[model samples]
Target: MLDLVAVLLALGLLMYLAYRGVTLLILAPAMALLAALLTGGLPILGAYTQIFMTNTGAFIVSFFPLFMLGAIFGKLMDDTGSAKSLAGSVSAWLGPERAIVSVVLCCAVLTYGGVSAFVVAFAIIPVAAALFRAADIPKRLMPGALALGAFTFTMSALPGSPAIQNAIPMPFLGTTAFAAPGLGIITGLVMLLLGLAWLNRRAARARAAGEGYGAHADGVPGPDVAMREHAQGEGFDIAELSGDPAPGKPHRDGNLPPVALAVLPVVVVIVTNFAFIRIVIPMLDTAWLAEPLFGATTIESVRGVWAVIVALFFAILLLIAGNWRRLADLRASLDKGADASVLPIFNTASLVGFGAVIAALPVFDLISETVLGVGGGNPLMSVAVSVSVLSAMTGSASGGMSIALDSLGPTFVDLAHATGVSLDAMHRVTAVASGALDALPHNGAVITLLTVCKITHREAYGDIFIVACAIPMLALAVLIVLTNLLGSF
Candidate 1:
């Protein structure tokens, strides 16, 4: 069909652009515009834009405000010595025996707090290197292990995931984090087990296979070269080293408070999602968990926004209650937050925009439509493969999700509605696959960890690819078996 040909050309071009670092944030909506022009011409593009506005409402451009807030909260914590206080407390309790795991856990907590994956990777890799060497775990294990820790919960199923990889589909699918709590929890636990298992297996394989895989990308004799190289950056600033609260005077052990503060945003989003969708929305014409503040936005859009607001609110309260001890430095903290957020905000929006346009094209329609018919029988697998394929094509997990969120999201959901899959199952599987595959190539989280750990795609990424690419395939198979054999209830 001419429609199919036009669609393919657009998708191919979109993929090429995505590979060039244009990002799904920009690529998505832009592609949507292209697809419209190619398929139904300009009129269709106008209609889709109208639909986008209705979906985004007036708050489309403001979505990143929450991310900014979360970043601000993180900046304040670091500036005020809150983060270190929290890290120190936990390190003490964890002991040197489980130091690597402790670092990973700490990083995960911060990720939930809304820090970028790159920031987490850079900050935490050094800690992992120190702790792993301390525990006699060897440097090489740091990259894979750190990657595992950071990617596990955050990638798959964290509530209030600031990543936007998973949440972007919520408005269309009617699947909020609250709707699949049990599934997400189980998925996370399964991934953690798999990650730990891989660690043990890889260590054994390395011992058996000989570390002769060579010094690895960071050019070290061990797996840790990646981590070592990243930490060697331009000496430490005094501000970063000594912002601790008076060096002593009753701290939250430097571990618990920062950890808790960091994790609070995610918890608020996940827990509130269910209540907002199931309990509140049905009662009112429209429900915005953040309605009081932002006036009736969808939870997905508002989740990041509200959590950051809450983080800011709590951050300020903590600062004021702590007697405005760091009040003079507040301006410095704000600037730090803004500086870090610019890249993520710019990239994400552009990437999402591009995907929106491409999906609206005949190429997306033809591919999506064809996949829908094939996947109609085994929806979970269909969704997984599509996301992974797109991710690999784009080199970003979140980017891959953006592609599916536009072209495949509605198609898959409609198929599920028509076929026999439960909405909850579909939602859970979608998030899991998105998080999992995002582990490969362009996944910012995986890339950050690798860059810091000084490992290369050849050495460590193969391991991640195995897990990210393979697990979702396995999950899809299982879902197919369960739904087909056991039947959806």
Candidate 2:
């Protein structure tokens, strides 16, 4: 049908243009209107003003706090030298011989602790570059190592992760960040071990072939225009990093806070997050939540966001207090972190708007029916596939997952209840599924990682695809099978 053709064309153009570096702010709305136009009889302007803008605004309202706090938290960590201290300590303790492991572990800790992957990339690259050179490992593999750690397990499968991917499913499933801990641990371990095996084996092959951190023109550490553009599209303002003493390079250990002091904020993030989810929020008198002015939502709908915000708030305070002497201009750092959160939240919101318009199309029902019709009567499989496909289409795990849950969350909830499926298992599946196929060539995160590492897709994407994409897919499959066999833990 012409409707199907129109939707596919719009999606294809969106993906291609996004991959070519067109900002999604323009592409998302433009492509959305294009689809509306092609679908004839649709109210194009109304779609834009009502459907698109409403969803976009709603997304911003619901998620802006998390984005602002997360960006500020990551910025504070960077400005205070905590991120560098942690990365350096990991590299030093693991030593250069374990360059790949050190880089992966460093990224894992930062991202798991709630630092933006962009911040993790910038923070870890110098340490990774130095280690790769020292260990005689090929520099091209650095992106894969970074991708495996920051992009895979910690971002999605790790229970208690403060990453947006992990947070996004909570409201839809009425689950906590620590959803299905047993299953999450198993899936996270699978991604970590399988990814390490692949990366280490590749490194061994390259070593046998006598390749060592090959020379490059832009090998020096610094964010170029391309990196900034890609980073901004993903919601990280690389301009914020320009204020750093060395900008792109890592700081010396002597100047960094002790590893204990540096890592304590991260500890605070996890501990306080757990405490608020299990103790603080539940103990509050949320009975007033039923009031109409409060959107008449329940505590479960808001608990996850509240926990993350409070945790990040305290963690930010701790970072500033511990590093006051080092944070030269405190106001500037806070201002920049606030500024950085804007673009990323809006960028993702635009994608949500685009998805809103597409979902409004009469044709979207057909699409949803087809998606729901699959999974062999299993709501878990249906939710996973839907989230994964949409994530791949939008090139954003959160964006895609948001759209899927926004539109189909209720339907899936009904199906789960009908089938006696646990909401906790659904939560874990949705979060893990988002991380699977969203790392395509067009993904903002993928482009930013390649740009940051100064490597081409041809050179680094194979391994990145395996670790961030392929292995995560494998982990998702494992999660589904285990959940199906044993039910939620």
- Using all chains and alpha carbons, the TM-scores for the candidates as numbered come to 0.72, 0.96
Per-residue alpha-carbon lDDT of candidate 2 for residues 1-489, written as tens digits (9 for 90 to 100): 889999999999999998877888999999999999999737988999999999999999988999999999998888788999999999999999999999999999999899999889878887899999899899889999999999999989988998989998887888889999999999999999999999999999999999888776433345665566655543444444343344432333356889999899999999999999998986799988899999898999889888999999999999989888888777877887888888888889998999889888999999899899888789999999999999999899999999899889999999999999999999999999999999998898888888777798999999999998899999999999999899999
lDDT of each: 0.55, 0.88
Clashing pairs in 2: 235-344
RMSD of 2: 2.2
Off by over 4 Å in 1: 1-62, 81-92, 97-100, 158-163, 205-328, 472-489
Best by lDDT: 2
Cα RMSD of all models vs. native, in order, equals: 6.7, 2.2
Would you give me the overall lDDT of model 2?
0.88
Over 4 Å off, model 2: 217-225, 231-254
